[model samples]
Target: MSETTALSSLKIEEVPQKLQIKNYFDLKKYPFEHEALFKREKVTSVIGILNEIEPYAKDWLKNKITSAQKSAYKPEASVISEGSYNVILENGAVFKPAAIIGFSGSKDTHTIYIRKGASVIGANIYLNQGDIYVGEGTVIEPGTAIKGPVILGKNNEIRQGAYFRGNIIIGNNCVIKGELKNVLMMNDCQFPHTCYVGDSVLGYCTHFGNQATSANFGIMGGIISKTITLKIDDKNYDLNRNKIGIIMGDYAQVGCNAVSDPGTFLLPYTIVYSLVRIPKGIYGPNVILKNKSFEKGITEVASLKI
Candidate 1:
């Protein structure tokens, strides 16, 4: 089938009544194209928006960078830059940023945009291929390797050993210490410590404990389709996407070492206990899900999407 014909056959929706979920999943500021986890309905929406504004943003950023390189950008005393990416130094600041230490990029595939008050403290941190855009007042610590097409908003903490691949968007005042690819984190969210958040979308102030993970793809896999379903109780909601991971709503918290099954969708203020293996379904807005490990579950990380 043709692409348009195939997309016309797909529809994504949320089933709140299945898990008895009510007043969960807000729609207001959602479907932001920069975000990774969004309703399948937003797919076409993003394409249209990107077609309009992406070129403009690129051109504007390029010209601004060129001007900054020629006239205004002044490297701080602590920096050890390779001089590959352009730097924009906003003047009249009280304090300057720390050393850029080490950074890498793909050939014309990405650019690194760092706003003022952004700091990269310590060593072994590298920004590799693709564009990495850090908004104002963000801090990145040591041992992290970030690839581009990632957008980080203001006042965030990109802590140690944080690994990122392409297509991730993080909002303001957030913390990310996990391994993420194609993930979207709303404002005030935290992914502190060892975790894998792939193809997921986390809402405001949602946080994960150490070692929390999202199992994104099929385990017994052959050909993985992006269309999947969310089963809550006897009801099934067609997600219309094959590679859906965790879609967590606002104020949700997962305890240490929690492993969510593929396509786990939790609503606002939901809490899952430590070492729990979350089932594949949509959960409540104000519920507490306590769980214990079965020990019979096989390790599923080997089948993860790259």
Candidate 2:
């Protein structure tokens, strides 16, 4: 089929009703709580709203950061830093043998902000690249590297070996030990162990087992389709984006070592079995997704309670 013909065949509204972002996430929860930008009625896509809000959010945060810089204090003896940064010691923050580098080898001058009661601990923990804001009482453990344009909420536990590439916004009380890039994680989510989550949005209390991966690109690359297209019920919905990972709903859980293809969407409370290679599409609100093998795709599903 001609490219235009194939593209014309795809429609956005054809996306299943169950796959709607509202079904998986509730904006009343963390990160977006009390935000007027999200509460507006006309904006339907949470993903789109998230992107739209980024610049404004960053500016708001930057203003606060600049204000806070007036009271910034020097780091302790063990801490090493370069370029420009600030550490606010309102409730007592700590950095144990950490290095903060504020330049990204370019014109952009990255700034690091460690809020009150936060801790960056490690033999060689590194924070660099773009602007970084670590929330109150958050603990970043050993061997973790956080590149910036990242915002984290209160009391998050970022364990050892965690590597955050960039463009991440995480809410309060998340437990993370993985590689993340361009992702938004709502409150109380747990990605406990090594995993790769890129270009994704994870809803409240979502959990990813060890080694779980949200693949964000097509294996075929740009050779065929430039953007990711989701097929639902044999109909195509062109997302018009090249790098979309999983869009998980509230309380969703993906088992250990499972892989979710690009543009995967899981509704609330969905549970995926271990070792399953979930096909790129929408699935359940309360169901168990199981696969006999990666090549076989999803072969079985059962109703789940909670």
Candidate 3:
């Protein structure tokens, strides 16, 4: 497809500056072609095409407000008792130790007290001194380290030897394994391998292939910053979190060994094929590669027009 043809089909009035970063990535080095396409196609039609490949995009956005609310809600201090410990940082902030840990095996006997509705395989599962809250129906494989103040939702499978850190919130039906450092995940996500997921928030149903990782700092070990602007209720807003890794929308798949640079924001349903390096941007649903002419791939399946 010619650039002009692709541009004529998309219907965007103007490409937001934040969404224009796709030009910097190797896969999408052509900006003028993408911008022109944006003018031709309507956003709804484009979203429809992406939805076919990633059905969970709309669901993820729909639940954002609820997730935000849950994050904002604070548990009462009075509700915490002696068996439940609190870790107070030097900044004077307090965190409940139990909410952050998950244990399995004979370790349960060592637990001073298990919180209400906390699940375990049996008394055979041991729990260290960390504060851990095992959500209803959550399962911890043998030999998993249950850190303090870890809040896990229902039906999570924490694999063996998985090391968890505090300030982590895992939503329902997620699978985690192999050295999950401080991270927060929404519902239905999976990190099922030896991947290092540290200081990140994963949207619902987002899947990470084996060894897919994201960097949080620059070469000098200094913090990296990137600006992200999203349209909310037709108004654009900026999320100013410096330590951000990647804000992937629902049903977005990160291929194996793919390394997303720090602060990468992938729109809903975008798929990164294996070994592909995506520069920052709002990548349209599909892309076509032809004889040095890169164009938007057809949204419809089996549309022989391309």
Candidate 4:
């Protein structure tokens, strides 16, 4: 097989319109060893970034399913399709689904679409509405709630009690369990346990430690202040959106219980230490964001006189 074919196989379909910001992300600075990684992720669109890069969410249930069958979206186990959407299998991977799973769509009815090798384990799970797409080798643990218009890519683990809302796409090889909405995650991302990530786009290999959160709403309640105005070199710029979360690049690790102010943009390899409240700004790449108390800064514990 040609190198291009191999590269394109794992690539998420690209879209136009780069991320709209000056010097926010320098893709050239991404320390990726493989050219394939750059090819898959190198999008410069600033306007509606996810909407432009998101290849799967544009099509409705019917279209996504058909595309999944042809693509590498493989399901190891058999899919017990029992819902409103039609299931079609043509020249594709073999799916010997072990058990007949079901959907309880009383509150929000959804069409569950699972590719070959994907497993939905145990009972007590519910998908409220929209179409659910489970990619190859992915596992949805018991007691998870997924409200649809969502897609899970290859080799992902959606742990127990993970709740999801509409307009979401989880990329390949991710381990995530959280309350989320309108989020797009890239490959090798690990985010689990008690985080509320809303209206955000996380890059490759990003991990959010326990109880960390991206506070999307910058506006204080009851007063009509909604837009997130960012200050760069004393010039304030508007993102032109009310709901904006942390836009973290690849290999960014958020320490436990850290809270990101709205419109926080973290570049690649940024490490935020525990309990650090990241301010709203365009943080350049490879920054170690940590909270330093004034007392700690003033004097060291060992040096201070008792």
Candidate 5:
């Protein structure tokens, strides 16, 4: 599909009149590569916004890198190699491969491919047991169970005891901590603690606070439904994906013990306070939280807090 058509399919929405594009820009750097692929015409403006955001935008920008990969064609080398240590993409990208060791289950049953420079240590780790592809430069620590059709991009560190199932695509420079489950992390993201991130897509450089979690299902226990889209200027771009978790813009952070409701959209540079239970779209760069009045068991206080 054409770029414009793709963007249009995302159902672009206009920013609130009270909000400024510069504010959004200042909060998070747009993913230039994804912009080039999906919104090239506006890339110049997006880059301008990045310049305006400066140093703070790096993490946000990195998170966007994965989106670019989504639109790019996968090279043949990545598709057919087995147990190869090095993967040379058609574009001449080079990566080191590692060995898949220590599996108690049937090796033939699981098809695990470790690109060059990637390493998987520890025993009882299941691979391709269900269709798993660990990309170049990735490291899977011991005690990890990776279910199939999962794509782990370059330079990712999967810590021990992490159980990831389903269709997960992890991008570059990410760190997956133990005790974490079913998460689709985009580029450069990190979840380094007991975080339950299920059925979600995390943007680049977004970090989850320890114990931070998101609820991806309803009380009835069916698949959670969320709408995916892009917001440019004042338009909403619609992406026709039925299962979506959170569309966190770059550099968004969820504090420890924070719980995000399903279908939440956290704009870049947004910070969720610790132990906060936030609804969808409650997070934005310039959001101000203030307590106007408070009542306590022994006292009452009125305060304006940011």
Candidate 6:
């Protein structure tokens, strides 16, 4: 087989208009209505948008929590309030409010909004100096521990042993069973089984199979930290941020045990096969990436001199 066939299986379906966030993501089908927060005209680049929206997104999330806290319309479900902690339950969703702890020891209030048809049974919610919003029909199973300052959209299944750090925004119908922090996940994305995703943006219908990881940091720290750069079509673009993960586009897939290096970016419909280590760069839309060693005829029996 040819070398090109062993590496990338499919050709690009369509080229993007620009290297902007809008070109990669399907904003029309994005579950969250926070496009204004992206400041599209101000920061068109994908990494630029993420850097520009970090503080704004946190503020927006806090505002949402505050608004929900002051809501006058009583839900038909159970609401338990004690001191600065409030747990709102709907559709028989059950969890011990005491398990939700104020880990930061701050004076700020903590609110958990579990909407209708959602459940958080036996899950531990850590009020890590922020609030949590669980949308309708989401299920957070036992052994899952979630740190607050998150907005989870409708119908997500957060399975057992899943761990979530703060500052995350998730869209509808996702299957999350991983360790996540500071990320935005769009509609229908899946990270089923143990995985690690941090400081990233996952687009619509993306999937990360079991044990898939996005390495977000440089190996060597201090004054001489490695800069994250993305090379696409012979052009090198440096992302100024110190830490970055993957900026996966819509319909992308990372196979089981696959790992993406820092500053990796996948265009729409890109599929990375299992056990592959994707380098720090920009990849394609409608393409299949695989290791050459995985080819069927590559293995040959040879005697070792040792």
TM, every model: 0.69, 0.83, 0.50, 0.69, 0.56, 0.80
Q: Give me the candidate number with maximum TM-score.
A: 2
Backbone clash pairs for candidate 2 read none
lDDT by residue for model 5 (116-203), tens: 5777555232343344555677787766666544567788888876767545556688888734333445678888777777655466
lDDT string for model 6 (221-293, tens) is 4667765655545545455677888889998889999888888888888888888888877777777777778
Query: In model 1, which residue pairs have backbone atoms overlapping below 3 Å?
Result: 225-242, 226-241, 226-242, 227-241, 227-242
For model 4, what is the C-alpha lDDT against the true structure? 0.62
Each prediction's whole-model lDDT (CA) = 0.61, 0.73, 0.46, 0.62, 0.50, 0.73
The TM-score ranking, best first, is: 2, 6, 4, 1, 5, 3
Against the correct fold, how does model 2 do in TM-score? 0.83
Best by lDDT: 2
TM-score (C-alpha) between model 4 and the true structure: 0.69
Instruction: Give me the runs in candidate 6 sitting further than 4 Å from their true place.
Output: 1-18, 29-32, 40-42, 52-54, 69-84, 90-93, 103-106, 233-235, 294-306
Model 5 vs. true fold: TM = 0.56
* lDDT per residue as tens, model 2, 90-130: 45777564777655455645456677899877724334545
Q: lDDT tens digits, residues 234-254, model 4?
A: 444555567778887777788
Candidate 4 weakest lDDT stretch, 10 residues: 297-306
Candidates 1 and 5 compared by lDDT, better number: 1
For residue 163, model 4's alpha carbon misses the true position, in angstroms, by 0.8
Candidate 1 global lDDT: 0.61
Single out the weakest 10-residue window by summed lDDT for candidate 5. 45-54
Give all candidate RMSDs, comma-separated.
Answer: 7.8, 3.8, 14.7, 10.8, 11.1, 8.9
Deviation of model 5 at 225, angstroms: 9.9
The residue ranges of model 3 lying beyond 4 angstroms of the native Cα positions read 1-130, 223-242, 280-306
